[model samples]
Target: MDVTQVLRMNGGDGDYSYSNNSLLQRKVISMTKPIIEEALTKLYCAMNFPKTLVMADLGCSSGPNTLLVASEIIKSIDKIRLELGHDKPPEIQLYLNDLPNNDFNTIFHSVSTLQKIITNPSCYFCGVPGSFYTRLFLNKSIYFVHSSYSLMWLSQVPEMAISNKRNIYMSKTSPPSVIRAYYEQFQRDFSTFLKCRAEEMVSGGRMVLTLLGRQSDDPCSKECCYIWDLLAETLNDMVVEGLIDEEKLDSFNIPQYTPSHNEINNEVKKDGSFIVDHLEVSEVKWDACTGYNHNLSEKDTQGYNMGKCMRAVAEPLVLNHFGESVVEEVFTRYTNVIKNRMSIEDTKLVNVTVSMTRKG
Candidate 1:
């Protein structure tokens, strides 16, 4: 499966679309707001009062939170400019980037909405469609970059792990070779991302990246990757019931890797282009919202809510591999499996938020 083609949040503003089901993502954006505010404020203060500021939001899935991020940054810059005794806002060339198949139309149509969000309304919105694994802008064009919950995805599944049948990601039962392959892919992809961004960003440019990550040092730690384990088990159940072929399940693996905090710092150090300003680990519960809420409610069971949340992100991949008919059943089983075994405590998905700046 083409990760770039199929890996997108559920489209549109409908009930099941990412915009509707992205409360968890919104919570994450909110959780990182302080860091964003501080970083942008500092960046503005550090720079000369230029007339235009170039900014890009990578992996900006079409959702309500997309423009909200831009608006928040605009507000930060406004306050900073006021403090610096500038009466006018800088012209911001705001770029929202995602995979090509992502619902760019939905985000593109929201430019009018953006005018209302920013204080000065001086930002020019541009939708740049592509993967963040490669460069999207001219050399030294961007002044600030932001990505959240998106960098966990690799550019592709590790080719060497094709023999890793019956597992979509590293599991407790996975062989050492399989584990190394996933780690190495993340290293390569992340290093390339930094190298490209280093060229695209001006000297002293800023980047704030928030992604799913492992809390433990071990890449194979269960806490870091238990969600995929439950997902694989759900597919295994379907295989037993003849709903999906085992070979199909084996062939399909999520092109995602959640690295440890140490690994993230190491990548920045290895890239030698950016200096890490701050790196933090924040734990978010699996059932972060109503659909994935821990307690079973009268309207939606824990399984049902978790199923919907999982569907929002995984539906595209599931549709490509198992067909549309199997999507609902698989997530139903996914939710049931989680409800039956994993408790509330096991649901913490660690988020690593790192703030960095290009070295002069």
Candidate 2:
């Protein structure tokens, strides 16, 4: 199947929209706010308050986080202008980018609200639809770039990944070949990303990228795919229940990679377009965004909360692969699997924050 054509966060504000299930992503964005503000602050100070601030947020899905981030950026710029007592803040030209199928209508609807929130009346918002692996704007047009929890997705599933049977992501049990395939895909995708941004950004422009990544250098570490492993087991259960064909399950592998610091730094060095200013690896609990519910059992709470987050981000790809009928069964099964593992207190996902500056 064509991964690019099918990959999207569930659209709209309905039950299945990524707008509803994106608590985890929103948490990650909140976690990185200070870093984002710091990066943009440094850029403004370094550039001596350029007259026009051109910024882009790649893979910006339609939701609260979308405008929240852009609004935060505009707010920062206005704050800097106030602190420095400049005659005026730069004209903020903001670009929100995502795939063609993203729920852009939802985002565009908030343009006026976003403008009203910004301290500066000059902030302008525009939605650019396309993949980030290619050029999305003119050369040196952007002065700052931000992407959150999005770079880990590969442009396409690797042909070699078909060997990772019955699993939707890389796991410890995956063969050496399967692991290498994932690493190579990440390398290619990230390198290409740097190349594109290098041309699109000004010489001193700053970029901050937050990816779901791991602390360990081992690509096979459970840190990378343990939750996915739980989901895989649920799929197996469905197959046993005659709800799904085992053959159908084997063909699906999610095109995502959780890279380690070493892998990310390696690609940045090879790309030679940016100097890495900061790289931090932090841990976030699996239930960080899943608030406690007194009405349900621990199992149900864990299952339902995690299920919503997973279903929101995963429904599009899963729906395309398994079709409409099985969507309910698969995620319901996935939730039960989460509930079964409620005793594992150490479950957390690693978040990587990398900030860089474009080289001359």
Give the top-scoring candidate (TM-score): 2
State the lDDT of candidate 1 residue by residue for 143-236, as single tens digits: 9999999999999988763467778888877778888888899999999999999999999899999999978988778777787888888898
TM-score per prediction, in order, is 0.94, 0.96
Pairs clashing within candidate 1? 291-305
List per-candidate RMSD values in Å.
Answer: 2.2, 1.6
lDDT tens readout by residue for model 2, 81-137? 788888787898999999999889999987878777677888888899899999899
- Name the regions of candidate 2 deviating beyond 4 angstroms: 292-299
Our model 2 lands, by Cα RMSD against the true structure, at: 1.6
In candidate 1 the C-alpha lDDT for residue 100 amounts to: 95
Q: Native-vs-model 1 lDDT?
A: 0.85
Clash-forming residue pairs, model 2: none
